[model samples]
Target: MLIVITSEEFVEDEINIIKRLLKEGLTTLHVRKPFFSSEEMKRWLFNFHAEEHQQMMLHQHHFLAEDFQLKGIHLKEEHRKSIKGKEQDFLEKIKSQGWVLSTSFHELQEVENQTLFDYAFLSPVFTSISKHNYEGKKFSVQQNKRPVIALGGIKTENIEKAYQLGYQGVAVLGCVWHQENVITSFKNIKKEYKRVYQ
Candidate 1:
């Protein structure tokens, strides 16, 4: 249950690094480029083998899920609110297609109350590595009802703490992408997560 989230901005050799990460056994990838148009995203995705599609999740252009058969679709916190009235039907459709459903949560209580998503992300368990001045809550999910993955500032050093705090998994952004050697960074995080969980 380790996941890698794409940097919001493009990184050099990103596609190749991602392919390498997948080959290195990355459990999942959350494609969260908010600015990418459907065409751009499609063209980018075209680089992967069809089998790699199952390891990917989309944060936008969910309609592409039908075309690419992605593993899941993520609802941004705002998008979740915008679709309030129609969320059930929307989620049911994705579920019917056998895709995993996930969304972001800023509060631990929000995750506990959630019943629609297969899993939810709880962020800032440590001060964000990618966003300046965004503080960490160090949220504890001991009472959560479903899987809650820790996001924000996750890296090899603190994976055990996240697990001990009751997170089912961790989602990484800056810890991997900000590194000079992305693959080594990712492998270290994954190894730490496995040591703590498996």
Candidate 2:
């Protein structure tokens, strides 16, 4: 799957771009607005069509996931660390509710050890395009047991390389949101991914 994550801070016309992305076949959209209050997040979510709501994964106010009928809930790396012991019960409840579970990882070992999540993100596979001085480590997914989506600095040019490295999917943030034409950038990345994977 080709996933697109929202920037931490909302960008201009982000909703429009996201709608267009869903219209253009973007299957997953991770809503990662850490600074947005639950009420603020609700108002922002209301901007989308009800049908579009299912395509999103919330990074905060997970209670909203069920309310919005969102696809899933995402745990930021820090959030995951904070709830170390309660993860099992949390995962069971979320899974029982049919919400897809996902989280982030900076290390390959963490990805391998976590099999309960439907998928997870392993980032910085390439030099980051949106975050300054955040270098890429090119983490390999060869040993991962669950689906591992490569994140950070993913672009059309290196998509094939990500596939070759054994990533089950790729999550694009900077490569799409930072562009002047988000839809066009998304299409290019999707095209490149299909060319390489299909």
Candidate 3:
């Protein structure tokens, strides 16, 4: 199972926790700090000294990715639409730089329409602190072969349910961020996910 850690929810000790998770085998680390400025993010990346084990992805800032040499960039559905006509241009730029691109979708139709990204995130698969009223009743992966990550409200207990429902992996925030022991929480979640997926 792959774990994608968001930077927004885990502000304090973010770098430390991320480093720990990367060492423990996190598949991807998405630096999704929408509130922070590009300069601030660059500063954080420089100061944090993120290791090579965790592939880093910036959110909605393709320019910064180019400047900082990040592995990839993630765009929201709205952002994706705004760049619709320029999809090829954007894809070419990302490809030229050898960067992976991903986007988030709220519906299956959107997922079906999106072909430019390497993966797509379908969120709120289960009720989560980051989101509410997500009972997994409306979430479905459909027939899309592209990797789709089930985000929002995913925990150690419900990860198996997510994978069973056809998600390539699960993205999380509060589940690990809110824990007093981030390392233990990540390790346990990773262990549980491996057991279920294996």
Candidate 4:
């Protein structure tokens, strides 16, 4: 459940770097290019192998996911609420197509409502480049019966703290994308995770 977020800012070579990382050991690759059009995502998916596509989850664009047969779809908190009362219906529809659902949660109440998806991202577990000054934020994992992943500013150094706090795993963005060496960064973080949890 080690999730790595893909960035639109990644250079062409960076895509290859990520592909290599995926081959090496990364578990989940979240295609979170908020700026990418559905056409662009489709093009990117077409370029990758089926194994890569199978491990990838789109950030939004449920229709595109269905069209491509992606593993699942993730929504931001705002997007999650827009379809609020119809969550069960929506989940059933997506589930029927063999797609899982995931969303973000900034509060305890959101985590408590576990009907939407298989997991929720409870973020800013540590100060992160993607989120600044997140230390003051509350990270309540007690309300979740389903798996809850810690996101936001997570890095290799603080992953143990995140797991101790009851997160299933950490979802990373800039820490991996903005690194000087993406593969090494991912391997280091992943190794630490395995060492600690093992």
Candidate that beats the other on TM-score, 1 or 4, i.e. the better one: 1
Off by over 4 Å in 3: 7-10, 132-138
Q: Kindly list the per-residue Cα lDDT of model 4 for residues 13-112, writing each as its tens digit.
A: 8668878988988767888877778787787778777777778888956688777777888988787768888877877888898987888877767687
Off by over 4 Å in 1: none
Colliding residue pairs in candidate 3:
128-153
Model 1, residue pairs in steric clash = none
Task: Say which candidate scores most in lDDT.
Answer: 1
RMSD of each predicted structure = 1.0, 1.3, 2.0, 1.8
Q: Write the per-residue lDDT of candidate 3 for residues 27-130, one digit (tens) a residue.
A: 68887787777777777777544354227887855687776677788897678769978889978988999988888887777776667889888866777755
Candidate 2: worst 10 consecutive residues by lDDT?
A: 9-18
* Cα-based TM-score, every candidate: 0.97, 0.95, 0.90, 0.91
Candidate 2: residue 99 Cα off by (Å): 0.2
Question: Which candidate leads the pack in TM-score?
Answer: 1
Candidates ranked by lDDT? 1, 2, 4, 3
What's the number of clashes in each of the models?
Answer: 0, 0, 1, 1
- Residue-wise lDDT of candidate 1 within 1-198, one digit each (tens)? 899999989799999999999999996999998899999999988888878999999999988877998898998888888889997888778878999989998887788899889899998898999999988999999888799999988888899999989999999999999999999999899889889999
Candidate 3 overall Cα lDDT vs. reference?
A: 0.76
lDDT of model 3 at position 46: 79
lDDT of each: 0.91, 0.88, 0.76, 0.78
